[model samples]
Target chain A: MKFVIQRNQLIASVQDVMKAISNRTAIPILTGMKIEVKNHGITLTGSNSDISIESYIPAEEDGIVNVEQIEEGSIVLQAKYFPDIVRKLPEQTVEFEVDENLKVTIRSGKAEFNLNGQDAEEYPHLPKLQTDDSFEMPIDILKSLIKQTVFAVSTMETRPILTGVNVKLNQDKLSFTATDSHRLASREITVKADGINDLNVVIPGKSLNELNKILDDTEETVEISVTNNQILFRTKHLIFLSRILDGNYPETSRLIPEQSKTTIHVNTKELLNTIDRASLLAKEEHNNVVRLTTLENNIVEISSNSPEVGKVTEEITVQSFEGEELKISFSSKYMLDALKAMEVDEVNIDFTGAMRPFIIRPENDDSILQLILPVRTY
Target chain B: MKFVIQRNQLIASVQDVMKAISNRTAIPILTGMKIEVKNHGITLTGSNSDISIESYIPAEEDGIVNVEQIEEGSIVLQAKYFPDIVRKLPEQTVEFEVDENLKVTIRSGKAEFNLNGQDAEEYPHLPKLQTDDSFEMPIDILKSLIKQTVFAVSTMETRPILTGVNVKLNQDKLSFTATDSHRLASREITVKADGINDLNVVIPGKSLNELNKILDDTEETVEISVTNNQILFRTKHLIFLSRILDGNYPETSRLIPEQSKTTIHVNTKELLNTIDRASLLAKEEHNNVVRLTTLENNIVEISSNSPEVGKVTEEITVQSFEGEELKISFSSKYMLDALKAMEVDEVNIDFTGAMRPFIIRPENDDSILQLILPVRTY
Candidate 1:
């Protein structure tokens, strides 16, 4: 492969693919990134077993990229060295040339480097998924959906399927659900995909995390494609593919309740701060549990007691209250997560007895809901 | 002890003293902060065996502080809990009271906390040092002096003395030296003092690091008092005490030479980048060594070769040359450090010989100097 590319453009593309390359790969060849130069542009691919990323740089981008030679060829260079070399290049433009024996040469200004290259044929190829099922959505909405529910996924790998977030779509609505048995987060959004059938897939939470880091917070649309086992998300010049878990996701519909014995409306910030204070003491306990009690006269008392560490009690005034007064004990972290996911200023928390799970949602919006199972503090 | 103080003021004092308190202290009382309430104001102190910090909050500070009680007493509370509790308090003014039994009550607005407090008498007392030798200097200059030389201290504790920075005062000049034997960094600054006496002390690098974090970048003068075995630094309302290491500092003055055979002047930034790029390939080698060779046409060549990895070569333009052309190889990290510490745009390097040690300093200034021993590359 022989070509010349801009410093910034190459750095951006290399950074995207570097996310998929792991330093601890058992297979030595898996650590290298495949580079291909054609008439159109240059394509870089990097993959582990779980996720794969492919980035492209056009031959001409707003007069930024200029390819001097049209030599169509491919080679695999060490991903670890390529990015560092490009980032620290002393010149504005970097030149690349490959000899007959596949020895790659990179030069910028007066600095020159020669790295032994491996045949690109030795690198594993990503399974090409048929674009039979594809959809497009705004990048902002997708990022928000992932942020709200991905954190609640089970980090323990005992049940491999539970480590992923389950996505369900029906024509016009998309639902995302994540639960670790103790706490659950669910969000739904409406998209403009016509003539698409029902879709269900389980994507690993770790893959979404990597995707989030490279994604810029812009209003551009991202095209998503899925096959039987592999799913692909394509943006302006980047493609992200993740392997899907093949298993039946648990039925989470029966977990959320329809009614509650008591409900309280409180300012989201006020309740969040009170719980944060109580957590300082409760964090020393085994479950980090804090108790919440609804008192008369529009007052709510939050208390956490650790026999070893002292006790903390706080009183916050709620905006309004109705129904029977109740007392509940749950993990302080769960409460904090539920409060943070809500976007509205005021939140309404519905309690169904002491032991039953409770639901929290924004006072004005019903699309985002969070549920937490109370801990047995007896 | 009973008192009410502004939250921000108390938080500031608590953070300042918390730096001295260690979580893994051998003595239980050492894990707590001593709080004393006097008729004039409140004082907080935290101490480990190596260092102690004390901060005072007066009864009234420009009408920002208010004291309600004249009670005078002292108690010690767990340093880990008190800081978090004070930071998360719900009111602007927090009320604190300790009974004769050492039980503490902290109340602010509708929140209350009851914590176990130990008698102040159980806390370790700081050593009293006689202030016979003292001097004062600008805090900014002192901070800069510490930052420029502390990073070169030997991290390995085999030679305990080398783990500290040696500061020696002679006549009107103060010199700081640090080394791990492989590389050494030293700088001298001029200061005015009334007494005519020479002094030398080795201060632990870890303590200096913590002090750096707490010292603000201000032009105010700080009074420094050196005793037989301890040093104390006093600012407006803060007192910092550190135990000095015992033993004599090695004679590094004899290591620097007064003559040279070759000298090269180059832009500090240009040479820094060249070494940085060379290190990328040299990193694969065990020593991360790079070679620099001066040519006849005011040109410098930087190169690194790793048998298993690859090789890289770069050239940097030099402004002027003197004496004979020379080539030397050394750790890239040492050269990078020397360049970073330089304040002037251009630097002059003196080469005693091809195998002998070399010196680097600002072209226009003589206050700072760096020396590096060449590595024999076969």
Candidate 2:
């Protein structure tokens, strides 16, 4: 393989592919990135067992030539040092050449590096995902959906399926839900879909996090295709593939409360700040439990007490209140996580009782919801 | 104890004292910060046996009120959570009141935190350093001197005394030197002194690192006092005390070479970048050795070769070169460290053949000098 490429373009592509590369993989060849030189452009691929990423640079695009003078061949280079070397090269353009014996030489300015390359034939082959169950959505909106629910996924591997976010589609509505038995987060959005509907898939939350980091916040569209055991997300210059979990996700609809004994509307920022301060002492105890009590006036008291280290108490004025007065205790970390996910001026919290789960949603929008199970703080 | 202080001022003082606090200290009281309310202002102190830092905020300084409503008393609060709490307080001013039973109440806006406080009597008292030998220098100059020599200190515990920087003062000249047996760095400056002519002490490098972090970059004077076993650095609002190492520092003056067989002048930045790039491949072999050879013309060849990995070579133009043609190999990391410490446009390097030690200094100044021992390469 022989090619001359722009240094900046190569750096960007290398970084995108490197997100899926991990040094701890059992397969030795999987730690190397495969580079292929073709007539169209150069393709870089990085893969572990669970996820694979491919980023391509075109020969010429929009009156600018990113790559030229190509001799078609393929080789796999160690991912550990290649990216760093490319980033620190002193010239604007980098020249890469691989001999018939797979000895790769990279030269830029007065600096040159020769690295041992592995045979590309030893690299694992990526499964070709072919299915008509594909859809397109704006990258920013997709990123928001991932952010709203990915945090609620179970980090513990006791139940491996809970580590993924449940994605379901019906008609033109797409819903993403994640829960860890203690709390749940759900978001819904409308998107244009193809013929295939009634599709469901469980994608690991870790894969979504890596995908979200590489994706730029733009109005450009990302095409998503789903198969039996794999899913692919394709953009103009990148392609991401992730394996789907093979277990049925637990039913989470029954976990959210349907009725409320008390409802209160409060400024989101004020309540978040109050709970944040109250949790300081609670963190020392490792429980991070805070109690909220509704008062007769438009006021709510948030407090936390640690037996050895004293206590903290704060009061916040709510916009409105109704139904019966109530008191509830829950993890301050979970409350903060839910509050941050809801980007609204005011939030409506619905409480059933001291022991039942409570739901929080935007005051005027029902597209997103968060529910938390109370902790027994007696 | 009671006092109301501006939140920003309290945060700054707490951060400064926290530099001396360590979580792994043997004495439990050392992990907490002592806060004393006095008629003039409030004082916060943190200690870890090796170092103690005290930061005071005056009731009124430069026509601005930082503290008010002070009742003379003192209490020690847990340093782990106090800094975070003070930073997140919601009001401009925070009121702290300690009851007779040592129950501390901190109030800001509508938020209140009650924390258990230990009696200040149990805290370790800072040793008073009474010495007639004292000197004054600009804070920025002192900070620069520490940075130049601290990196060369030995990190191994085998040579306990080498873990500290040797400081010597004579007449009006002060010099700092540190070495790890392989390389040495020395810097000297002239400061105003009183009552002392010859003095020598070794301060632990760890303490200097913490002190350097808290000291601001300014032209204000810092008063330094040296005793038999301790050194104190006092600024306008802070007093930092460090225990001196209890051993005789080795004689490093003889390590510098007296005469050289060859001398070369080069731009500091160009040599640094060349070495950095040449070291990349050398790092894989766990021995970062780079070789430099002086050619006939004003050019130097920098190269590194790893048996498993390939080799790299680059040539850089030098300002001037003289003496016998020579080739030398040394650790790129040590060379990089020495080059970074010299804040000069051009540097003069003197070599004594290929086996003896070499000296590097600024082109025209003698205030700073660096010596590096060459490595034996087959």
Measured over the true interface residues after superposition, the C-alpha RMSD of each candidate is: 2.1, 1.3
Interface DockQ of each model = 0.67, 0.76
| Cand. 2 TM to true fold | 0.98
Clash count list over all predictions: 0, 0
Candidate 2 positional error at B201, Å: 0.5
Q: How many backbone clashes does candidate 1 have?
A: 0
Q: Write the per-residue lDDT of candidate 1 for residues B1-378, one digit (tens) a residue.
A: 898888888898899999999999899889999998998888899999888999988887677555656489999998888899999998998989888878888899888887888889988788776665777778888888888888888999888999889988888798888887777888899988655368789988878887877778542987777887888888877888998889888888788878999999999999999899889978855477999998768999999987656788988889888998888898899889878877679999999887888989988677898888889896
lDDT for each candidate structure? 0.86, 0.91
- Top-scoring candidate (lDDT): 2
Interface RMSD of structure candidate 1 (Å):
2.1
